[model samples]
Target: MRPTDIETLVQVGRPTIAPDGAFAIFATSRPSIEANRSLSRLWRVDLPAGSPRPLTRGSGDRAPQLSPSGDVVGFLRPDTDGRTQLFVVEASGGEPVQVTDRALGVMSFAWAPDGGSLVFVSPVGERGRYGDVDGLGPDAESPRRITGIRWHANGAGYIVDRPTHLFVVDTPDLDAEPLVSPAPAVRPEGAPAPTARVVPNEARALTSGELSYGSPVFAADGHGLFALVSEIERDRADLRSRVVEVSLDAAGASERVVVDRDANLTVDDLIVTPAGDLALLASSVGDSGTDFVAACIGLHVRRDGAWIPLTDPETIDLGDPGSHVTALADGSFLAQSRTRGRVQLIRVTADGAIEVLRDDVEVTGHAATRDGATIVAAVADVTSFGELELVRFSGEGVGRRITALGRTPIAAIPSEREVAGRDGYPVHGWVAVPEGEGPFPVILQIHGGPYAHYGVHLFDETQVLVAAGYAVVYANPRGSAGYGRAHGRSIRHRMGTVDFADVIDFLDAAIEADSRLDGSRVGVMGGSYGGYLTAWTIAHDHRFAAAIVERGFLDPVSFAGTSDIGSFFGDEYVGVDPVEIEAQSPMAAVSLVRTPTLVVHSELDFRCPLEQATRYYTALKRQGVDAEMLVFPGENHELTRAGSPRHRVERFEAVL
Candidate 1:
């Protein structure tokens, strides 16, 4: 595939099935190289089996949730003002009506159990913090005071001032007609001032505080909500949220904590089952409140005021998107589980018996029925991009692919390889070779998230390099996720030690196993933690002919202050000691590097920060080694994945 093929690629968001399983609607988005923004539209499938049709035009539509009776679909879309407001359209079809007009915009929302009203989480702060209350723009806004560590996010700008709160919006009758303009003139007799029977499109705050709230799910009674609450103002640290019961009444603002926060726990998501049981996905934070290195996210079910742990945290690491659970008819729940690079469905019974449903294909997004008869998921194997597949809960094969919209056909099949570390641990990876290759020069790519794993999917990085007459080898060595907590924590304090060994061991094993890979012409490259490892590899091995380090966490000391999660990220992964931190950093070994290197960075990348790539590139140049730096403006660490279409293609070109 060519670099421009990035635009041809399509992504499917989580599918939402109607309560009765009559149809399914999901959002499909693709990056537009020319527009330089993600384009999205909602598509609906008349269920059991039917052709998918466009449901709503694109305004970056997202989170399409069906109303109680499944007649209207409520989703978030940017209003004319460019703030994400709630919109609803008849499931059958029609122009979506804007149902909400909030200044700060909706972050997440849930329909009331009765469907008459919906609760959304939106930022509530004094006017002008977001924009002036008057017609003036941002330049007329008031000054802000500095506060909090979690004040801003990587891609999102300063957000500490606008703490999110619960807001309930009563839905206007779908059949209601447009109101007459300016209202009729009042008669001399004053017939109720000629009032218009118009339903308000405004929302009322349900709860108010400096704390931030999100993932609102209405309580079964419909008079309350269960929202994930983060004590950001109370504790300025890595967001640790707890589940609470939020009352809708004015006198009910006093929240009853359902699931209290624990130093060992960080809530990921929360949802109510058909029986009103609250199920949550959370990961262990250890005692440090930030021991976040490759922590496993497990499932928890709260029934009748008693919360029960469903999966063992150390052994079961549910994929991030997989945490969304669909309650089945048999008192069991269906959620996604990640193991060995493949994310598949797993059934968790109320009693905590875990059963793997499918393991052959990785499920990127999914929706299931209450009866467990039908399940729709975005599935991708080694050679294909994600395609919507309809599968039975108790399926035998890949049930059936329902939509051909997101499929990206592969030109060459990927070969999976596993190797043992020198200390006798397993390392996994994949090798993609070009069609006409004798002994192709190899590009050894490493993934970020020492905790994130490489999986069987249409990874463009490997596909693009292989198309350019270079064999691409990438792997999930030690410190990668989907391999249980032990494998992830194995490299916590030993950053570039065994993890580096596993990467090298896997590369060597791949060369020995595949005849098409040229071991002598090897080039190493990685981003984030992978970038750190890449620099360390060149400095320590001196065998690589070239290296490309993008967004590497080179200097731990500097990272501890600049990175968004740097406050505790370094203390957990590396060490708190000044000497030990330096010793473990890749920057310490940069003087030994002799390989030609290309340092790629995004100007707005706050995760690794721009200084990371710049520092590595400067060190290489000073040492008299060939080096070059490429920086993309208005981009972040997610440049390779979510950057502009043109920039992504340019990155591929630079890699070549």
Candidate 2:
């Protein structure tokens, strides 16, 4: 693997099964180096065992949703103005007709249970803002009067100025031109124009106000909908969200239900069972807004108008916030669960019974037939980058591979292992060793989310280093997801103690386990949380000869005001105590570092912000320690994963 290999990687996700469980459709994306962006398209595959074929031209298509009746598939694609809009196409095959022409891009959309109409979430700002008209950008807009803590975000700036609201679009009217123009140029005089089924454009907002709403699912009768609502306040400086049910009747609607009562709850994924029970992944931000700081997300179900805990809040992690969850026909729920290092599909009943349907596969996104018989999942592993895997409970064995999106770029599979921590606790991790007889230079890499873990997957970063003749070792320490709650919450207020020791323990054990690893020439490198650990490692123990800290959260003091999630991140992850925060910060102990360091950061990274890298690098240089700084303009904390193709290549080269 090389830096240029980033362009060849293809990612597929959001698999949805058909009503009869005979076919499925999923989205595929590949980065175009020439265009410096990722191009996405939808693909359909016959279930059980079948070849995958392109359904839509690979042109910005994403988030495909299969309608209730399975007569059509609704997806989001860019309009003429590059704003994402709702689109629908025949289940058999044909051109997709645009269903909306929202001023701003559509965030997400779902079909009504009865399949008569669809509901979408979009920013309902005041007219003239966010390109509402033909030609208007932020430069032409007036200043904003900020009153919320979530006024600005990392990638999407000034979110509070135009709160996102929900609107309903019905398809009653089918022979007219599309609500939004087609992506390509207008047809010639003799050519035909696509017709959208009968329906007016967006009628009106079903919801409005300061709070933002998302993850909406329609009721079985299509008379109401359930959505997650976020409420931000000024005093506590934390984000609090809950689930609510709203009457779908635009006029004379007066009923609303607040589903969850836990304060400081961050709702991740929400699903409504066929029995109408609610299952969601959420974590309560304990009293100090830091109680469950580093713990994995827990699963909860609504019973008798009260939220009931289903999965163990500490140990069982049900993927990330936006991970997909399907409600089965028998009242059982299907979801991708994170355990140890693998994300496997699990079946959870209304009474809290869990049965693993698929194991040893990293389930990224999944959808199951309401019967819980046929399951289609997007999986990634050591040998495969990303592809679709099918699993059938009605069959005798695990389901077969359903799609091969692209060629696999990984040259060798990483060896997984578990080593003992300093305190005798077992630490799980993996190592990718280059093909050679002699000892290779080592790179001990750390993962970003102290909560995020290194799993069995084709990671471009480690692959490139190993291909360049370096041994890369990474581990999921005490503060990582997968393992149970005790492991994830072990490092809440103590960032660099046992967690740091667990990482060091893994690195040392890997070097000792394999003779190919050179302990003397070891260097440390990581991004975000990994970056902080890299700086912290060098500051305390100068075992490494060099270091690269990219977008590290160095000082919690300044991070409270600068980061997009700064309102409660610093106080929640680190501590509110000034002394403990400073003592644990990598920047405060910069004087002890002697390793030659290279500090990397994204200029617009609101997560860690550029100040973290600047402060650490400047302090190292001021103290006469060797240090260098490299900053990428217009990039955020997701630079490595979603940055421009050329910028991604440059970042890999920097690591090399």
Candidate 3:
């Protein structure tokens, strides 16, 4: 049930299906304990006879894209200074040709249908203006300056703004040009809609106003484009987003909404079905859990004025709900379902009946070819290392499996147990004991988002802590996501009340049950809301010997004014108004802290800024509670996943 010892889990990303459906390309990183450090390589899988083969051997290759014609593969690679640039290689696997040599970072790119061109988005300068919200003064000349009215005022505190629109590249020669030019003028309040105009090399404007749009997909007929438009309304509980279709032939365009609602829903993946309908994968915050639910993933036909859903939501979640559906050229579709925490590939008839095609392998990421017969899936299990598998299916049944890429084993099975929470509710958690047989120091690790769940995904940080000779205990308390709506919403207006007690109760039970856990040598660590919980626990109880709070909010009132999702957090998580904020904020209760703690924050993180960490650090120091602060430069809320490789390693080392 458990690995011999804990090791770092390799990070995998950007899995894309090949045109012929015979294979997939993806990026994988080696495990490292250092902060802000990463080394990734590109790999390809062949569906029938062979395992996946490495296409690029060195570090910094990522965001793999298989060309439309399946003749070439493109990805981003690090240059001399470590900034990423685009590179392309032959489908047969050979030397890669560098495409872009820009000083700014190139994070993403897509191949054009004709295979002679591509489109990409990257930072414009060495110090990009993308995420800068303060606006450049006279001396600031960087193109990465953050714009867009709503983002400017909300100040999500990101180091870089979203890239400046889309850009197109002519292949072979590889020259790039912005797709939308002249940047639409900022319209005044209540102003009449301006006359639509098209700029050369730029796509027609689909939506107006200062809000931003991205994730563009060309229709099957290539006559229209589907893009996601975000509108940030002042004082709104959540950011408003809608999918709009725009005409490609006309200079002026009209848009029709594909998905629109009051809740926060962001499109994650989209593809045109072989039947000429749109299939999409979206993430939304619903009443149940965080609603990471997969939508139709089949087909949505346009009818009357709106697009109608072809696949039923009930059916999508029935056999396998969270799995994505991919359309095949022959009109049949591939549906992936999660059965008992493992993913299975199922072939669905046009009428909606499904037959399990592949069930033995554990599938994570999936991509289908133009024909449904072949599938590229990422497969891994408790003992198996991460790898991309090329799976072929035919009239007979599931076809042969070919390895596409291999990853080092990075996860360990911590002992699983069910403990009683403060309210006597059964809480499930994992306790990863260090290598030594005798009692080891314990670290109470908490997950962030408050509404998110820590599921069966191969997590690296947990293994890292275990390797550091610390017994790590991570639990799903009442408010954690994935359980159901009632459980997740339990801590809404009672942040420090029940949830806090749940952690204490769980730890008490765990220490009593496990002799390998040293109760007196315990420490606590968490990020974002988890950080808030860590701060709150140390202030209210003296059970912990040391604590680390990463980018956590200390004052609900100040957080409401500064955090990007302030309105939503204030209205739902904590009760509205300054009174409730004061009652729930850990900073407001700083006078009670008596435990040693470490405060960590990123300078550019808008979610929970450095000020929040500083406030807690200052309070603990002044109150004679030992404390220290660590700040990461040019990092955002995603410091753990996307920050500079070196800094990420440092942060882990400091806390450990």
Candidate 4:
């Protein structure tokens, strides 16, 4: 496990079981150095035997799904036009046939229950009242009208004129060649075949208007689709989302509101069960200190005709950071969530009982069989990379791993340790020591999210650091997810004060417990929120030898005005007022830093933005402090983790 071997690792995702439960298909991505990009391909594994092989070739192939009939598998791939179009191949073996040839590309798609067609969402240019598209194209260069605060995203870029909408395409007829093309059709001078003139069952738009749809899901009976839509006014302080039911048969039809937006709740990730019951993940939307930025699973039973909150808002979290849900045959739902420091699967019973199904490993992707008898998940811990694991559930909410699919051998594992925060709250962390060492130089890495948590997962950055002969220390402090709501909410409105103290306390505990860590030769580094802590730590304390700050907010005032989520990030996380945010900003004391700092930033990172790094570096240099800056062009905030393998390795080399 050398630092350069990071490029050779195969990252697996979306382990979906086939309809018949004969095998499983998943998305695997690895770096292609020749192309200078990551190639994601689909792979299949025999169910009981767990023998693995490639199912699709080339790059940009992802989101593979075995059709309901179990004869064909559907996936998304980029065509010659660079637009992601639907493609399907025989379940046994054959060449894949291209389906839709849309210009903007399909963002997401789901197969119908009856296996007739697929409902997909793709970006469409904004249209006038008369339904004429305003001038927008794949190569059009024009000024985009700026009207909304959340108009541009970090990775997605400016989304002003183009918005995503829902459409349906027949998958069966997609294999046949079209009857007409630019080359001209063989028809008599005056006689023309009407239906034959156009491709049969052409893609139809089921949704329209100035709105955006996310992850549309088909109903169990295939009558309609349920999806989260952003129809509320964008100028509002907080963006609102609600679930809408779209009719598959009607064009430009009125959609029914399945779940209306509540004053304090943001609902998303809608899933429908075989019983027709709707389940959604909802989080509290507010600037209150106890606001639940992380959502919990909510259930809406059709029989009762009302939505009921399944998990406790203040006590239970969704185990994971994002909103995700999977419905079962018996009307129960499974979601990835964290309890203390490990992300696991939790089952929300049909009767409203919350139980932890598996709690030892970090489950990233999971899918269940139609009958809910077996489950397959992509799991990993501190010791290994993500691999497909067979999971079985029994009575009383207990689960066990049956087998590992394509498991990668690990060289070393981190030792878990518990330390008390300055306020006496328990903080969990892991320390990775080198093979032969005494008082080794240590690198303390803090995780971002201030809302996100670091679990027992195999973090590449940690592994690479350890491979470079440096002991790495990572932890889940206060404000991290998986330890319940109070633990996360504790850092809200407090920011650098509480979490900073927790990090210092954990470092002291680590130094006292282990004799191999060199307490005097320590380097600090972090990204996003962790970046904020690093800047703050070096400013307040002078013990660090070097510091690395990657895409972190140095000034809350500038961030509140420039960041895409700036309007609400500081107000909700730090405080409701601008004054409170300014007081807690790391920039307030950045001039006090005297350590050699290396600043890493992505040019296109709209979340933290490049100005954050530039302003801090300029300040540090002006103070005559030893400092350097590394800026990655055309990259976003995720550069440290999901960026190019070349850049990731270069970042580690610079850190060392």
Q: Report, for all candidates in order, the number of backbone clashes.
A: 1, 11, 28, 3
Residues 350-425, model 1: lDDT tens digits: 7888887667778877787777777788777765665777776333434777887644546567788888879898
What is the lDDT of every predicted structure here?
A: 0.80, 0.80, 0.64, 0.76
For candidate 4, the per-residue lDDT at 435 reads: 79
Which digits, one per residue and each the tens of the lDDT, describe model 2 over residues 1-656? 88898776888877887888888999988777888888898888887777888889847998888888776889989888788888888766787777777777788988888888888899877767876676778788877876667667887766776778778888533455545444556678998877643235555678887877888888777888889877656655654466788788767444475665454566776777787766777766665554556555667776666665687675678855346678887877777788767888888876778989877867888887778777888888777778888777354456678776547567557898998787789999999988877599999999988888888868888889888999999999988888887887788778888888988999999999999899999999999999989889999988898999999988888888888878777776777898889877888888899999999999988888899888888999999988889999989888998898889988888777
- Error (Å) of candidate 2 at residue 209 is 2.0
For candidate 3, write residues 42-137 as lDDT tens digits: 877655555667888867787777778887888888877676777778767876766665545565665655676555554332242533334755
Candidate 2, run of 10 with poorest lDDT: 172-181
Evaluate model 2: give its lDDT.
0.80
Better of 2 and 3 by lDDT: 2
Q: Model 4, 336: alpha-carbon shift in Å?
A: 1.5
TM-score leaderboard ranking: 2, 1, 4, 3
* Error of model 1, residue 395, in angstroms: 8.9
Better of 1 and 4 by lDDT: 1
